[model samples]
Target: MSGPAVRFDAVGLKLGGVEILRDVNLSVAGGAIHCLIGPNGGGKTSLVRCLLGQMPHTGNIEVDWGENRTIGYVPQFLDFDKALPVTVSDFMAMVCQKRRPAFLGLNKSNRRLSDAALDRVGLNGKRKSKLGSLSGGERQRVLFAQALIPSPALLVLDEPMTSMDEVGAAVFVNIIRELAADGV
Candidate 1:
C-alpha cells in the first residue's frame, strides 16, 4: 500500500514469432500518476495488457495492495452496437449497480451515485439521452463516469484523452487531480 503499486521485472512479450516487448522493467508507486508514452505499435498497450493480466508474458509482475484494494479500468475502446437504444442512465446503472438485478432497475442509492458520477464529468444533463446519440467525446466521458462509481484504489486509464475535446480534456485533468489528491 505504501510502496510500489506494481513492479515489472525483465518483462518480455512475443506474439506470432514477433517480439512485442523486451526486457521491460519498471515500478509504479502507489498514489502516483504514471503515463506510458510511445508511438503506435510501440508496445505501450501491450505493457498495460501485461500488467492487467490480459496477456501472457515472461518475467515477474508483482502487485502490492492493502486490504480491500480494488482496481478500476477504462479501456481505450468501447465495443458496443451503435444502434443500441440504451440510455446513458441505463448503461450506467448496469455497470455501477452490483446488488440489484438489471431487470429490477437501479435502486434509489444507485441512482444518486450514478447521477453524481455523471455530474463530475459534465454529463448530468445527458443522463436521459440515448447512448447512441452521444458524440465520441461524450461517450468517452461516460466511460470515465462509470469508472468512478466504486472508487478503486488503482485506476487504469488507457488513452483516455483520445477523443476528448478541449473542455472535456480539461475536465478530465481536473478530476484526475482531485482523485490523486484524495489518494485514489
Candidate 2:
C-alpha cells in the first residue's frame, strides 16, 4: 500500500480538568509498525484518539501521503447491545458495503472482500453466528476482519490482542506479516 508517515507534534489533551497528555511528539515512518505501550490510564488510547481526530487536542497530526490515504482502524473493544440480532456477516456488511445499504445485504464485491477478511482472521465459519453470541476473542477477530476489506494503507490497531486467544493471536501475526509485506 505504500502507506504514509504519520507525525504528531506537541500534542496535548485534557479532559474534565485532568491532564491526559501533554506536549507529546511522535513519528511513525512509512510502512513501519509502531507500538505505544503504557499503563491502563496513561493516555495511550487518548493519544490514539487524538491521532484519529476523535478527540479535541492541541497538536498537529500529519499524514504525508502522495495519493492513497486510506486508513483502517481496529479498536480495543466494541460495546453493543447483546440482544441485537446482528450477525457476523451483517456487521461486516454494515461496515464494508460502501456503495449499497447494509440492510439490503452485501453486494458481490463487498461480500467477497468480507469473506476473505474473515477467512484471514480465521472467522469464516462464524459468518452466520450472532455477534453477541461469539466469544470476546471471536468478536475481536471480527473487528480485525472488517478493517481489511478495502485494503487500507494505514492500519491502526489499539490493543488488538486484548481478548484474542492463542489461535487468534497466531492468525493476527500471520496477517500482520502479510500486510507488512504488502507495504501497508
Candidate 3:
C-alpha cells in the first residue's frame, strides 16, 4: 500500500510456440497511475491477463497491498447473449449487491450507489434501458461503472477507454485521478 503495488521481474510469456512477452521488468507504485501503451498484439492484454491470474507465465510477479487490499478489474472485452433481458440497472445491481440475491431487488442504498456510478460515466438516463440495446461505447461505460462499485485498492483497466467518446474519456480520467489521490 505504501510502496509499489506491483512488480515484474524478468517476466516472459509464450503461447502456441510463439513468444508473446519477454524480459519485461516494471514496477507500478502504490497510489499512482500507470499506462501500458503498445501496438495491437504487442502483449499488453497478455500482461494484464497474467497479472489477473488469467494466464500462465514465467518469472517472479509480486503484488503488494499494505492492508485491506482488494482488486477491481475492467476487461477490454465483454461478451453477452444478445437476447438476454437484462437491464442496465439490473446488471449493476448484480455486480454491486453483496448479501442480497439479485432477484430480491436492489435496496435503496445500493440503488443510489449504482445510479451515481452510472451518472459518473454519463449513463444516468440509461439505467433502466435494456443492456442489449446499448451500443458498444455505452456498454463500455457500463463496465466502467460496474468497476467503481465497492471500490478496490487496486484498479486494473485493460484498454478501458475503448469505444468511449471524448466526454466519457474525460470523466474516466478525472475519476482515475480522484481515486489515485484517495490512495486507492
Candidate 4:
C-alpha cells in the first residue's frame, strides 16, 4: 500500500478526566480496511473522532490527502430514529454540504455529483423517495452514496452493518471494499 492517508503518532485522548486512549500509534493507507475489534468502551469511536480532528487529543494526526480529497463518513443506521419528511435528494444535499462546508446549497454541479453518487450506490432511481419510505437497505445505501458524493479521500464508518439485513450488509461491504480499492 501507499503511504498512509491518515497517521497518528503517540496519540492519546482524555475526556472528563478519564483516559480514552494512550500510547497509540497507527496509520491507515489510502486504500485499505483495518478492522478494529475489542471489548466495549475501547475508545473506538473516540479514536476515529480524534483522527477526524473532532476530539481533544494529545498527539499529532497527519492527513496526507491527495487532490480533491476529503473525509466521507457513513453514520450508524437510524431506521429506528425519528422519521424524516424530506426526500433522499435533500439528504444528499446535506451530505454534500457536510463534506464541503463552502458549498452554499444544492447547485447544479453539486446535484450532478450527488446524482452520480446515487447511481454508484444503486439509488439513482430513488432520489425522490421519501427518507421514511425507503427500505432499510435503501436508506443505508443513500447515506453511503451521500458520503461518497464528494469523493472523500478517507471513509469513516462506525459499525456500518448495524440495522442492515444480510443482503444489505453484503452490498454495503462490497461498496466499502470497492472504495478502498479505488484509492478513494
Candidate 5:
C-alpha cells in the first residue's frame, strides 16, 4: 500500500522550559523515503516523537493517509533484561500475537509471517536462540523483522543501521528498496 505524504508545518516543541524544536517544516511524499540527520541532542528524535503522538508540540504534524494508516516503526534502541530467557521467536510472537499468548506458541498465520520476516533479516536460524545471547547487530535485526510483519503503509526507522554489519546493512538496504518500489 502506498503511504501518505507527511507534512510538518511550523512545528515547535519545548521540554523542561527549553526549546527543543523551533518552526521546523518538512514534507515527505508518499512512497518516498526521507532521512533526518543531525548531531547529538538535536531535535530529530523529539520531532519524531511528536509525529508519533508520543509528545505534545505546537503547530501541526499531519499524515494524510487517504484511508489506511497502518504505521510501523523501528526504534533506535530497545532495552530489556539481559538475563531473561526469552527466545527470539518468543519475542516476535509476543509482539505480533493478540488472540493467543506468546508462551502458548505462535498461531499458524503469525508463525508464517514471523518466519518470513526473520528470514528476510537473516535471523531465521537464530529464532531458537535466546534474545540476550545475540550481539547488538542481531538484536537490531530482530527489531527490523518485527516491523515488517504487518506490511505497514508507512515505515519509520530511526538509525536502523546503528549496529548492523556490512552484510546486514546490505540486506536492510535491499528490503527498503523493495518496499519503496512496492509503494510502502
Candidate 6:
C-alpha cells in the first residue's frame, strides 16, 4: 500500500454547543511538514483533533494515495499513572500490530523489531527499565518510540514538543525529519 496525502475539505467542528472550527480546509500532501499556528482556543488543537477523528466534524478528509493508512498519535500532555508497570520494550511492542503486548511469547523477529524502534528513539538502554523511572524528556522519547515503532505511514503529533528543552526539541526534530525522510 502507498502512503496517502491527507486532505481536509471544509471541515467544521463543534463541541458542547460551542462552534470551535468551521470551514477549515487544508490539503496536506505526503512527504511534507505542515505547521498550524494560532492563539489559545483559536481551534488549532480542535482542527488537529478533527483530522484525527477524535471528535466528529463536518466536511471531508481525503488521502490521495488511495490505501488503508495507519495512524499513530501522541497527545500534547501525558500525565501517566505513577503506578504504571510497563517498560520501554512493552510500549514499543504495542506498535507491531499486536494491539497488546505478548508478555513472554514474542518471537525473535518481533524482539528485533522492538529493539530497533527503541534504538531509533534513543531509548534502547531503557528497554528494561520502568516507564516511571524516565525523565520527562526520556519519557517523551519513549512515547515517540511507541508511536513511530510501527513505521506507520502517517504520524500525528499534537504539541509533540510541549515539554521538551531546546536540546531535546532539536533531537526530536531531527528524528521527525529522519522519519519523514525514510517515509515512515
List, residue by residue over 1-184, the lDDT tens digit for candidate 2: 5678999999999999999999998889888677898899999999888878899999799999857778889999989998899999999989986678777888888889999999989999999999999999999999999988877888999999978899999999889988888788
**TM-scores, all models, native as reference:** 0.92, 0.96, 0.89, 0.81, 0.96, 0.85
Clashes of each: 0, 0, 1, 0, 0, 0
- What is the Cα root-mean-square deviation between model 6 and the actual structure? 2.5
- The positional error of residue 15 in candidate 5, measured at the CA in angstroms, is 1.5
Structure candidate 2, residue pairs in collision:
none
lDDT for residue 159 in candidate 1, whole number 0-100: 95
Error of 6 at 53 (Å): 2.2
lDDT of 4 at 78: 54
Poorest 10 consecutive residues by lDDT, candidate 4: 96-105
lDDT of 6 by residue, 60-122 (tens): 877665454677777776687857887766655655646445565345787787777678766
* Candidate 1 lDDT, 144-165, residue by residue in tens: 9998888778888999887889
Write the residue-wise lDDT of candidate 4 on 90-110 in tens digits: 777776665654324467788
lDDT of 3 by residue, 82-150 (tens): 689888988998998878987676899999989898998889999889898988778988998998886
The TM-score that candidate 6 achieves is 0.85
Task: Give lDDT: candidate 1, residue 92.
Answer: 92
Instruction: Specify the poorest-scoring 10-residue window by lDDT in model 6.
Output: 97-106
The segments of candidate 2 whose C-alpha lies over 4 angstroms from its true place after superposition are: none
Q: Is candidate 1 or candidate 4 better by lDDT?
A: 1
Worst 10 residues of 5 by lDDT: 66-75
